[model samples]
Target: MAVSTLNVQKCHGKNIEGWSMSITNLQAWLQEEGTVVLGISGTRKYVDSVTMKWLIAVLYFQAENPNAALSFYWEPLKKAVRVEGHVEKLSASESDEYFHSRPILSQIGAVVSEQSKPIVSRDVFIERRAMLLEQYGDGSEQLPRPKHWGGYLVVPEVIEFWQGQTDRLHDRIRFRRPKSGDEPDGVLLHQGDNGWVYERLSP
Candidate 1:
């Protein structure tokens, strides 16, 4: 058996700011339920433009093995992105190699950014960035991926695709697990009309 529910809410007179706020509120609500997975669509340039493009990040409680969940979700995301004409996964060695390939300035930037979080002033960050560049400017590959800076994979139990239509009649298709079954095989497959039906979602 599969269980699902649709929630409809009106956002009358609420502007874009309000919509953004509502998303935060919804995240808080979902967190209370259990682990909540999120997906967001946006241009890469748009994400790269901002100092932090974390608007769409998966949130789950701090766990003993947080990396486990991340690894799970990351696999399918890599596949989905590839199917949509994007690059595929980077092996651990590949990831390490890519880190070494980064420019010295970029490596310094990563270091400086990690030390300066929740920044309030632009000039301060710029100065710090410049200072790091100068300090590490021998153009050496000594810098490594920051201890806190790495990728996490999330194994999604459910994936939902939402398409907007006129008059606010959106199209939503969710895939979840059946109430009774063995664990999903975790194989990603492309399906016509159904899109990617990798797993069954609990409706």
Candidate 2:
């Protein structure tokens, strides 16, 4: 298993880094505490593993808050990969599959909600949801996923890890994907072997 960490406060920065681990532990961590920092049109958000399974693709984030920043984390790949490129939304079929997999109530809610739009009252939303449910569901029929709801895939350009230490002497490791065939200079650790480079940063 591997892990990735990004510091959103530093800007819309992302990194991917992780150590070796068993597949079982990897799945367990993902099921338990897996999380990532995200940015969308100036609003930085934190998407836990559960929420992330749905919103996979991460578009560039630009939080309206002046202090906001965006971050992304992932781990343990077969080969070294780079992030920080164009973000891609999921395909319609992919979106549909994900949507159908969600709870019926979630589908109904997403369909009924106006998203970021302001609402007049909770009662109106409740009424709309009830009506939509009555029309689309009888408990057996699988509801369709909302058109506006889907996932994003964030391919990171750099990967980093931070370990807190005594008195703020923390240990930070980073892996930056090379722009050219020439790999970056540093001691690269690859699958118990050396294939890529990783730099230790002063905290």
Candidate 3:
């Protein structure tokens, strides 16, 4: 998931100091910035989150994985911005590589346990563990990746950026792409394809 911040600029023909400005620029910014592949902590800092406070938006930007993004509204930030996207399970190759790299015991335990199910007790678990370990005996042989163990790729269809000020006044910027495409038209020219639009909202 991507966590991001939104800010306003008074020069953009609206009252940013008054906590309202069009999000055309903000949307463009995300489309461009979201493509960055920094680590989680690096992304947070690189996005310059300190520019916005009071609202924390979670954005899933997977440029390297898939070309998608997902933003969720924090309870407190719900009144600020709203965006949605789709998620896809990771591929078998990805899961298999990770499954085999785990410690042999964990691989065996994964084969035995049904994650997220209600288990009887630790003793029951331990009993199952003992049996699996005795049966497998920690061999270099590979174990199959359990169907349930895998990650997801998220594709964001729309993005909303928001900032807040005093007296419940706030600013909201929404960026939406057509269902058929993701490339956007913006202040800066993107390399290829253009299909995104932006709108300002009352807050």
Best by TM-score: 2
Task: Please report the TM-score between candidate 2 and the true structure.
Answer: 0.54
What is the C-alpha lDDT profile of model 1 across 53-88, one tens digit per residue? 122231111111121111111333322210111111
Per-candidate Cα lDDT values, in order, are 0.34, 0.43, 0.45
* Candidate 2 residue runs with Cα over 4 Å from true position: 1-85, 181-196
Cα lDDT tens digits, model 2, 40-93, are 211112222211222323332212111111233332421232223223344668
lDDT by residue for model 3 (135-160), tens:
66657445666554443333456767
Error of 1 at 123 (Å): 4.9
Any idea what lDDT model 2 has? 0.43
TM-score per candidate, in order? 0.40, 0.54, 0.42
- Among all candidates shown, the one with the greatest lDDT: 3
Candidate 3 collision pairs: 2-59, 2-60, 68-155, 69-156, 183-195
- Candidate 1 local lDDT, residue 202: 29
